[model samples]
Target: MSTEHNDLTAANREAWDSKAKEYDAKPWQKKIASQVAEALNSHADWLGADWASASDQECHLLDYACGTGSVTRALSTHITHATGIDISSAMLSQYTSLLSSTHPSLVLKTSVADLCSPDPQPSISGPEFHNFDIAGVALGFHHFANPATCIANLASRLKKDGVLFIVDWLPNKIAPGEHIGHAHAHPDSHDHNHNHNHVKEEETEEWKKMKKTIKTNGFTEEDMRKIFEEAGFEEFGFVVLGEKFVLEMNGKKVEKTGFIAKGRKV
Candidate 1:
């Protein structure tokens, strides 16, 4: 790996380790749990709509960089089991604690290894990696050091006819703090009593640091399409799942216009 690439990966691990607690503690982050849950359901829906009904119940999922495992919790019912992998143990720890409480009987596994490793190259098959029917990368593309390798790894892990899902913020051309807005409507029971700008300064600082090291502002449509194609996936489909998330960080209301993208392995 290039020095810059290694630096970015290390920086992401450190940044996430430092901010894992605060990141998960944010009121918005907590609220996102259900929205992500809903998104997972939508992924299930999409699979049924685009593919067949028989494959629904037996599918296994891989939650790549599954920070806090909110999606894994939501996905408990739709698939046979799910495995979450991340580079930060702190993030996985938070995920485990929440997983045990929210879905006590969930069959979940976690690892603190880079799925996008380049040297030995992380394995994507066998008892260790498992054959994932659906693999989702939620809001994680920007943190990748080499997206081609990352997507390739993800694509390689899928069972035949399996799909890869990518959900993330739309790319932008400006600095932070411009897209401020009120939080979206979520269920009242999951709501919290917190201000939008509560962690503005800290997140903004993190954003600045991300601007320096993160791979991209976010992935564009063409960017993602090319990525999927380069990874040897076919029949790419993109779904606009609405703005399911928004957080005021560093005084900027970062609105999340998520996409439920899928690439089938033919």
Candidate 2:
């Protein structure tokens, strides 16, 4: 890996490791987890025919960048086995704890692995990591230094006709001189706040440090489609959720519109 990419990976790992405990405790995070889980389950068709027809034991899932097992928990009832991998060991610990407590019957395992690396670890390159019926990353794409390479790496692990999906923020347009911030908002809540500059001046430093870990603010549908195609995937589908994810950053709420994109391995 280039020095720049290595630096990005290190920065993100450090940032997420430090915030893993707090991230797992956030109510908004839990709420968005439920929302994403519902969206994925309701739109199963988007995942492709392989996922729909596979028996529980045969339905293998790879939740890459799987922090706290959000995607795994979301599909716990549907699939019997899942493997989760993340760069942050702390995040993987949270995922392991949560999965054990809530879905003990489900066979979900997690490890600290960075598949996006130019040379993946030996354990990650084994047969067990390949031939997944479905692979997914939830709210973790923006942290990747090279999302296209990440997608292609994940795609190479899937069996033919396997599905790959991503749930992440849609591109947010910021006006000049406006700072990005999120406030508490939900689809059912009538009280809405659209302003993106409500964060207090004191929190700038914290937000700045956090922003350094993010490679991109968001992604557009066109961008997603092209990336998926270049990654050797077909049957592309994208859905923008009606609900907004309320994020707590530096004691301020940041509302973000989320979307789901999926494609089948060709």
Candidate 3:
């Protein structure tokens, strides 16, 4: 792992661990999480058909940066089996509770694996994921200090013709803006809003979270294509969501946030 990626893993762990306790209770988080997962499932209808045509069985999917396994739980209905990995133990603990309560037999599993660390992946202890059909990341990836390298590692883990479904905050629109000041105007401005104590300190410090990080890490669309191609991915495309295209300037309703990249390993 690169030193930069290591730093990101640390930051990501801090952010998620801080948010884990309140995550389920936050209505917005719950709604967004569910929507992202369901959108992925709809996308599967398009991508899954290709895998099905290739004779793939019930999908074996890995949820990367799976904070509290919300996406994992949401994905259970679409795939045969799912496994979640994160660097935050607190998030995984919540994930464990959610899995235990629902989808107990969905081949649901969780592990602590820092994608930016030099260490090997913690034991998954299962026959599945050996040749997983699909791999996914939700609102993650940008947290990687070296997202290009992270993508390479993830792509290498897939079976031939496997698909990688990536959903992340796009720097183009969702990047943090002058909205901090505007946000202060909201009627619900409590201590958490003013003190910045509730949210991760770094989140408030950054301008556009992923943009600066990606530039600092030297990652780009070309970098993604190169890594995926080198890892034997045969097809690739992307969907930009939220922000300008999905919403009007008036902030009525359009898209929510971020973009999704899908690549097929061949």
Q: Cα miss at 90, model 3 (Å)?
A: 1.3
> lDDT of candidate 3 vs native?
0.59
Instruction: Give the per-residue lDDT digits (tens) of candidate 2, residues 146-245.
Output: 7888899899888999889999976555433222322211211222443456453454665656766776667778889989999998899999999888
The list of candidate 3 runs beyond 4 A from truth reads 1-3, 49-57, 122-129, 173-227, 242-256
lDDT of 1 at 161: 81
Instruction: Give the 10-residue window scoring lowest on summed lDDT in candidate 1.
Output: 180-189
Between candidates 1 and 2, which one is better according to TM-score? 2
Residue 250 miss distance in model 2 (angstroms) = 3.1
Over the stretch 69-171, how does candidate 3's per-residue lDDT look in tens digits? Answer: 7667766766667777788899988888878788776777777775545456656534554567788787666456555566766776677778887776433
- On the 0 to 100 scale, the lDDT of residue 119 in model 3 is 53
Looking at candidate 3, what is the lDDT of residue 230? 71
Q: Count the backbone clashes (under 3 Å) in each candidate.
A: 2, 6, 2
Give lDDT tens digits, candidate 1, residues 1-266: 78767787888888788777776677877777677778768667665423323655455778998888866776777666678888889998988877778777556777777766765544333565756778888877766778778888887777778888887765444334222111211111122334555453233566555454455655556777888998888888777667547765545555656666778887
lDDT of all predictions: 0.68, 0.78, 0.59
The deviation in Å at residue 228 for candidate 3 is 2.8
- TM-score list, all predictions: 0.78, 0.86, 0.70
